[model samples]
Target: MGTLPVAKKKKAGRQKCSSKPVKLPDDASAEELARLARAVAHPARVRILRLLTDRETCICGEIVAELPLAQSTVSQHLKILKESGMIQGEI
Candidate 1:
């Protein structure tokens, strides 16, 4: 009878998917797309943006009044949107 071939031992480590770094667009608009998407990731943020768009002017209190969320929560969502460059605050 012929002897069976022995199987080689497998290495126990996470395999790398790719060694090369992924290339992303250098344009401001391309970068902004991701930021804007993240900013509106929450339902509250989407609602806030929609409300703002419908009005000529708005305030934090106004936004809170329109939504079911608490003032602080609304403010937090607004802050995220602002920081992501999706909204502007008036003085």
Candidate 2:
């Protein structure tokens, strides 16, 4: 009888990854970084930021249409972003 071929075994250990350390500007303060973190803390906020980044300008109605949230909910998110200096709007 012919013997079955043995399968190759994969190494059982954590793979080593080489990465460069990120460098921040000297003027960037911890408070500023924390504020920025707070700005995109929510999933909806992150999505909103991504949408805004894709276009030079977008209206509130357009943002509302893209998200699953209601108009009011989107408005609140926009308010947070605006207050955090992550976005700007006209009166």
Candidate 3:
């Protein structure tokens, strides 16, 4: 009997995300503004934004190294920022 190929299982926990900026329709800006505001609402997110602004680019590991939070925490923050179009990267 031929063995069936097992489908690869996705790892649990924070999944990888692309930080590429997502463009929205012109009319969508107002709706997105609130989300963007919330994304930067946290101090940690603010610091992350500043770090990216100062450096112009950063890897997820680099951001995590600079912050006191755990890697998972940083990843979550990055995800929010990326989703809001505040920052872009592969994380």
Top candidate when judged by TM-score against the true structure = 2
> What is the lDDT for 61 in model 2?
66
Write one digit per residue (lDDT tens) for candidate 2, span 10-45. Answer: 233211111222333579898978877897899998
lDDT of 1 by residue, 24-74 (tens): 346658666877679879999888766765654455666678999988787
For candidate 1, what is the TM-score?
Answer: 0.63
TM-score for each predicted model, relative to the true structure: 0.63, 0.66, 0.64
lDDT of each: 0.56, 0.59, 0.61
Ranking of models by TM-score: 2, 3, 1
Residue 21, candidate 2: Cα error in Å is: 25
Model 3 residue 45 lDDT? 88
Which residue segments of model 1 deviate by more than 4 Å?
1-26
Count of steric clashes across candidates, in order: 0, 0, 0
Q: For model 3, which pairs clash?
A: none
Name the better of 2 and 3 by lDDT: 3
After best superposition, candidate 1 residue 40: deviation in angstroms? 0.9
Give the Cα error of residue 25 in candidate 2, in Å: 7.1
Best by lDDT: 3
